[model samples]
Target chain A: MSDTGQHSHDHTPRPDQDGPPSYYQAMETAVRELLIEKGVVTAEEVRAAVEAMDARSPAQGARVVARAWSDPKFKARLLKDGSAACAELGIDMGPTHLVVVANGDKLHNVIVCTLCSCYPRFLIGLPPDWYKARAYRSRVVREPRAVLGEFGTEIPDDWEVRVHDSTADMRYMVLPRRPEGTEGWSEEQLAGLVTRDCMIGVTLPKSP
Target chain B: MTARFGPGDRVRVRWAHPPGHIRTPYYVRGKTGVIERICGSFRDPEELAYARDGQPERPLYRVHFDRRTLWPDDQGRAKDGVEVEIFEPWLEPADAAMEGGT
Candidate 1:
């Protein structure tokens, strides 16, 4: 197996920027060792979970956006049932509600988890550091349009913006409005424009 | 499992501060909003966090609150809103007074 891109951040005790394990690291180590010692979960299982996390990336979500752009029926299905529609494209969404809020002419959508960092790992992989930062977690819910603006996305004043706070089990994705001037583009070509931020609703899909 | 609130139902989040692993945010406690969608049933996260079975699964809903309601100092132009995932136990029927006051 390739060692590149084979690292997991979820629950992984990473060293601080100053180059030492923080208290959280020590705590995580202790907890992990104890859990393993009790036979609750094997060390092998932990390694496998890390590998699975490593395998996931934004490309999975991009594939779904590309399919939706090319197929209207599929777009409708995705908006109606995100998990099932993703499954149709061979994506295995785990045990959580994958809610897709479509971006329309009159409305925009953004997502955040105020309590903790709960991202759609199956679709878009690990979230960026900014997404999990304390400031972002606190500010995004209160001022989403402003947050989007910080990302260089300018939404008109007229469009109603909706900030989705993922307080619990449900995970949300912003189905960005399809860009113009790309009539009859192949799904592969369309997928190129979908960035992780675009899928997250901070940015729009790039135009041709 | 039957759902207590459907889409468009106006509800008030009960303001309680019971200890240990709450999914509800502190800012949203005792807030009022409308149901955006039903999220089906799941074991209570509060109980699940403690390794409890969380028997009798509870229904979760996507609740939408007006931005002005959530943050009184919001500077947005129009009626931009915030939607949150809330379990059934935390929500109750919203009254006009509660909506306007809180």
Candidate 2:
């Protein structure tokens, strides 16, 4: 047995965890604790809500996209009412409305929340860090093509690049056009090609 | 609730900026665009932000602004456009909206 207690290692704290919680973080903690103390919500309920949010992933949105590609009826419903269509597939979008925009050979759609980082969290889980950054929020609306180029996506010269600003009550998700050579493919097979970036309209799905 | 502006109706975003939880982007203010579709009525986010019940929901519309109208620079292609969700209160008929006036 080695004498492990003889020496102490001065370990550096994680850079992100070194400082105190941010203003919003502290406010959230205070409010949550007060709510729990007042019996408004239980700790278990809070934990369960967090777990539910974490459980949601890009896979859910991919499934919806795959289904839409396989079924025209679902695609129409998705375009008309994204929230209800998603609910038909058991993905509850909560209160925020979802707006699904389609991409085609002549038109490409990209989504950004200019006011804040509003996203289709229920369908595609939490948004990526870049989506929340001010650079993306401002630049995507001003110069979308350049922003897309930074993501390694190039918009054709003649093609139209439409940007959806998810301001106010609505959230947006881009329904990327199915890639070529995917004919007769099953929904499961198609789902694999639908990436989070594709749904966000930053990049296209890779062909298998 | 009935929508004031229907699809294809040209509308302009009100330029006035009140200090509150406003959802309209600054860039679109005073800019003219065609109403793409009615996005249904929803609670007023301006009031809802203050924990108040936004009584009598307001109609929302998806307004499509051409990139050229919004930005004069050569940023986007000619067909490029940007659509924003604007509450009914922030929009007025394009014909009725004039420079230096409401």
Candidate 3:
């Protein structure tokens, strides 16, 4: 209902380029066949893994953001112990530790996997094509504000841009600041404002 | 595991050229930063690359770097910075000169 007045900006940043396919495909096929022949794993298992990643979406993360915005206690728990907080919220990421970084008056956090596409798939679904692109992986680290500008997010010149390179061992989700004017908005109403890009630190949550 | 550094501690990542998988970003190597928080130790990603269990787990610190030090040519905000998770073995205490860096 509240969504009617505003748009859901998932940012669905389309993939702008193709990956090195032939080399990776050949290597992947060879290794996969060998693994199957050796009985290390089954084709079904591989398919299931893909399916699991596909099953995840931004809504899982949006719920967490909505609750944190309305409930300060939950926000504290989410920031202090992200895994435990998500578990309580029923967003199961299956042991991959999640870290919630908060944006403030002077600082903002953006996520990028520099070495590879290491993401919190259980929480926010597949990495966008742009997310896995060389342009993003390389530029976001060196020039964050510039990359964010491509997404139409203009940060004030005074605020510090803290880019988080999700290299290994942990995954990150930006807890965007709740928009103003909806002082009495419901959690579902608030959830509508939170978008995938907002969680990625490229854009702010749209106002209702 | 005990944390060698905490939030606000100044540190520098050594620019080691490991032959295999590494989680540290190249842009951050040799750059000095302030410790944001200590992400508890886990399997070392380098060892994990070779399929070896990253045992004797290493502490990973969230280090904050100055935007200028990372991209010297950039004309962005002076207060802007970058935060990256770096394993303990790859980092060391920054010299006093580095501690004074923005």
Candidate 4:
């Protein structure tokens, strides 16, 4: 069958200045009004919940994991049991437990939620749109080297690339090894090296 | 369910046709490897992301495949091999064991 040239766009319309409501605005209003009318949830409650959620950030957990990478004992603990180790670093694991896989010279680790976007949300916060996108989920496990290469990581032929499927119950976070140029770096400095791509094992932490 | 494969056991990821939303990566498909470690059972993320709960947890396994096996045509001066995690449902034992088990 020849490929069709059809494209599907689901853009939500934006409101014109002092004009009629946009498509998204209309839908949002309809849903909110329906909820209020049905007495399911109040409009005020929705606004309050959104505001409270916006107040928190994932930086707290990132800092803890970064520090642990610089500390030998903490690194050991992190590998032994990541959830409890994260707590020691002041990061809560919440309802989900996490397992930290360390990437080194011999083994390279990459994580994917084969069934969905089950990430270590307690520590990493919400995953980016790409993390939940179909392209990533379908491509990463099938072509890890290529996908990782697009993210600027080139796995050497000699080093084994291990893709960790984050299916079933456990979540995964990659604790990348400290870069050579970053010796004696402070926790704050080290945190800068911990990018989302690195945590996902698609890229390595940047060196000094 | 218990893992049918274990660390050092060679296996292959069963090919899966992607539809709607899926998390299995595209590169590691059809690659063969030795089981490196068992990462325990958990909820499948594809189902969880879509709020499809009540699905049974499946055992997760980490498989290590040689880089040469993945890219036979490449000529780079570096260590060879790649390790990937596969659910119990995605793997089948290889007909013959390759080197570097465990």
TM-score on alpha carbons, each prediction: 0.88, 0.93, 0.85, 0.63
- Candidate 4 lDDT by residue in tens digits, B53-73: 927987878677665676666
Q: Comparing candidate 1 with candidate 2, which one achieves the higher TM-score?
A: 2
Q: Poorest 10 consecutive residues of model 4 chain A by lDDT?
A: A52-61
- Tell me each candidate's RMSD, in Å, in order: 7.3, 5.3, 7.1, 9.1
Q: How well does candidate 3 score on lDDT at residue A8?
A: 80
How do all the candidates rank in terms of lDDT, highest first?
A: 2, 1, 3, 4
Candidate 3 local lDDT, A55-158, one digit each (tens): 88999999999999999999999999888899998878797889999998888899989888888788989878998899998988877888999999888888
- Candidate 3 all-Cα RMSD: 7.1
Candidate 4 regions with alpha-carbon error over 4 angstroms = A1-58, B1-6, B9-33, B41-60, B63-102
Which numbered prediction scores highest in DockQ against the true structure?
Answer: 2
For residues A1-208, what per-residue lDDT tens digits would candidate 4 score against the true structure?
A: 4456765555778866787899999999999999999999988999997765454355755586677767889888888788888888666677666778888877778888766787877777678888889899877756677888999899876677776666455788888777777777788988987777788788888777
Query: Which candidate number would show the highest lDDT if scored against the true structure?
Result: 2
Return model 1's CA RMSD, one decimal. 7.3
True contacts kept of each: 0.87, 0.96, 0.87, 0.49
Q: With candidate 1 superimposed using the best TM-score fit, by how many Å does residue A162's alpha carbon deviate from the native?
A: 0.6
Docking level of model 3 = medium
Considering TM-score, where higher is better, how would the candidates rank from best to worst?
2, 1, 3, 4
- Which prediction has more favorable lDDT, 1 or 2? 2
When summed lDDT is taken over every stretch of 10 residues in candidate 2 chain A, the lowest stretch is A9-18
Alpha-carbon local distance difference test for all models = 0.87, 0.92, 0.87, 0.73
Q: State the weakest 10-residue window (summed lDDT) of model 3 chain A.
A: A1-10
